[model samples]
Target chain A: MTVKSKHVRIKGIKDGLVFLLDDKCPFEDLLSELRYKLEHSHQNILTGPIVHVDIKLGSRIVTEEDKEAVLEILKSQGNLLIRSIDALEAPGSKENDEALFLMSGMLRSGQVLHHQGNLLFLGDVNPGGTITCSGDIYILGALRGMAHAGVEGNEEAIIAASLLSPTQLRIADIISRPPDEWGTRESSMEFAYLTNGAMQIDKIHNIVKLRQGLNVFKGV
Target chain B: MGEAIVVTSGKGGVGKTTTTANIGTALALQGKKVCLVDTDIGLRNLDVVMGLENRIIYDLVDVAEGRCRLNQALVKDKRFDELYMLPAAQTKDKTSVTPEQVRDIILELKKEYEYILIDCPAGIEHGFRNAISGADKAIVVTTPEHAAVRDADRIIGLLEQSHVESPKLVVNRIRPGLVKSGDMLDIEDILQVLNIDLIGIVPDDELVIKAANSGEPTVMNPDSAAAIAYRNIARRILGDAVPLMQLDRKPGAFSKLKKFFGMG
Candidate 1:
């Protein structure tokens, strides 16, 4: 007897699985099909190798209810991995060497941005908004917010902002807020980095050079 | 339409019950129908604070569990014809009520009242979730202490995460003497950390205790400083731009003389 195999193309990325579903199929149907594929295949659905699922919704804006349903399915399957929806037409993957991401949007209160690479913002970091980066962060607008760079203990991570009036700033183990005496200084870029085992900020122009050494701030 | 406002403080003893009573009374005094829902089941104190404990024939848990009708559980205040109190069940636990039941009750109350003030229990647990589920807005009460501030911060975070927009701040029990001496956290300090709009600041007043004992909200007393502050807060909520009270002013001999003479 000959059996025809039902195959779903799967591409493994460094993070997890990238599953592409046809836009014609409804999301619910797609979920059921994926479940059936996982159950009948040699791969174990419970302890599957896939740790992440990036669904390419392709031109469709996933409704809140749809997102909840997707989350529910993953949760019930005991596979609560990080899931993200991406537009199929999104730009091609950029090289990891180019680690800078420039985001320009109002981060409303209560929203958090967690980036594993450098981040630059051209807008205000409103109160109650937070930015956590494993690399450096630079904000061109007022920083009346919280910023944590080098969160993964990267001491070399630096934070610079046009207006250095943050509620709190953290780089590695050191945390500091603008001194009250620094009260409303002129709008100029200030750089913060580890100095003498403590986080310190000074005029960006003063650092005439940047030395790439162990916790050394080479004057720019 | 009536709005449901949750009076919550993540930490205990920040005066949520007191604020609920004062705001409820203030709104009632403005000729609006108001009902206060006490959601702190098993530890009901809003009834005592509002001086309606003796009038409570049925409680919130009874209404939620279908043991009593909503109208039967509502306790009308003796001082205000339009003000009513839904006392929490002293015998039932927080789990006796669910968020869905609270939402249903609030929706029903909205049809009959202009304001529904829910007295939320302390701590960010099941009770807090149930209390806030039906709220249109929230007033977070906090004292000027490190622990209170930290807990308020956490609550603010949770509220934001749950998508409760525009949570206003009320710094209760502020001691002017401590603030003036830099011993207590000032309004500016709290505002800087919490980053929420300040609605009111109630200075520590012994009259508050006296008013609670008499089942009268301080907001009804014209001479009480805290009462005046609460009234001003009510006006602000009504979209009036009332200026915040100057709590840092020193009570010098001249001020005392002016008080004695009944002149500024």
Candidate 2:
């Protein structure tokens, strides 16, 4: 029986049951297996007359129709009900690291956050906190720590922050530090990027300068 | 519920034990039921600094290992009716008590006390982890030296990762004379580096040493400048908006003479 149906795995959680469906399996095969399991083990799975189960479609991009179809299959079982349905998190990448990540709180010294794609931070990176990403890095608060963008050698990646007074800034293979007199605590947004094998820091108002720098590098 | 605050400093001898003793004593003096826990197991000095060294029957290891009751291990302060100290075991290492056990012991203490201050051991080792296991807040102690401030930054990172919210800063043993003469890191400089809110700034006062030698915290001596600083910190802990003390030094006669004549 187990060999015939090897797609959906169900487990008991505190609030209710959780159905973890293998993304490699076909949607129809998973739905039928879920229906059979819910009908066969409803008494053992639930002490109550009615129960809600959460379906985690790991990495499977589910449309509204797919969600409705899954719900319809559970409704046919009569005993099980749908609580929450989680679908694929992001597009264009099989790995979750490619998705945009957002985090808040004080990123203190000695802590390093590495992301494969664009990262957004809503807190201060205090002194020693390091942010290393293969893509763009955006910070809503002060970025006083070390930020290394395009760790995988993506030169187009930019590191931007509301207060970009970092200890060190690295874009692709280029590394640079701000001048000694650059400790102005202004509330303006600043961004840093690599151009012509050097790192350049500019205010957000001078965004055209960044594009011009990139174009000049391309021309060279 | 009572607050469990851990006073920690990654670098040794920056006055974690001294700050714990003074702040705990000051809070108790302000009528808050406070308990000081010495989590620095092997090198226990909070008991010595609190002047309750003679009254240790059972230690932290005893309470954690279930050898004695929690109340049996607590050494009551003779000065304050509501203050208590849980002395660390002198013979045992940091591994004697686990973080979970420390949390359990603090949970029990929280019921009876209004404030629980854990004097953490230096370094990001088992003792420091155990000290912050049950802390709702943290107080990072540091001197105005480069090494101490760097270590404090590292400790603050660890504290943030452990979910200890908004760890306040206490710059200890700051020499105003050196700061005025451009030889020391002032409060502003340290604040710029650490980026944490300042709770207290204790000057390099002789009274702190004299009080510690007698096993009494500086907060008990009203004549001491460090005492006033600790009292202000304690009051700030109680949600009072106390202003920081002015820590400027008066120029001596030598500096005055230098300014008066171009060549003497």
Per lDDT, the best of the predicted structures is: 2
Candidate 2: residue A96 Cα off by (Å): 12
Best by TM-score: 2
Lowest lDDT sum, 10 consecutive residues, model 2 chain B, at B255-264
Candidate 1 lDDT over residue span B1-264, tens digit each? 788999998999989999999988998888889999999999999989887788889888888889989999999998889999999999888999899999899989999998999999998899999999889999999999977877787788778777466799999999988998999999988876677889999999888999999888888887778988898888888888999997865657557547734796
Candidate 2 Cα errors over 4 Å, as ranges: A1-104, A119-122, A138-141, A160-164, A177-192, A200-220, B161-165, B192-195, B249-264
Relative to the real complex, the DockQ score for model 1 comes to 0.06
Q: Write the per-residue lDDT of candidate 2 for residues B48-167, one digit (tens) a residue.
A: 888888889999999988999999999999899899999999998999889999999999999999999999999998888899999999999999998899889999888877868889
Tell me how many clashing residue pairs each candidate has.
7, 0
**Stretches of candidate 1 above 4 Å error?**
A1-99, A102-113, A121-131, A139-148, A151-153, A161-203, A211-220, B248-264
The candidate scoring highest on DockQ is: 2
| Candidate 2 chain A, run of 10 with poorest lDDT | A211-220
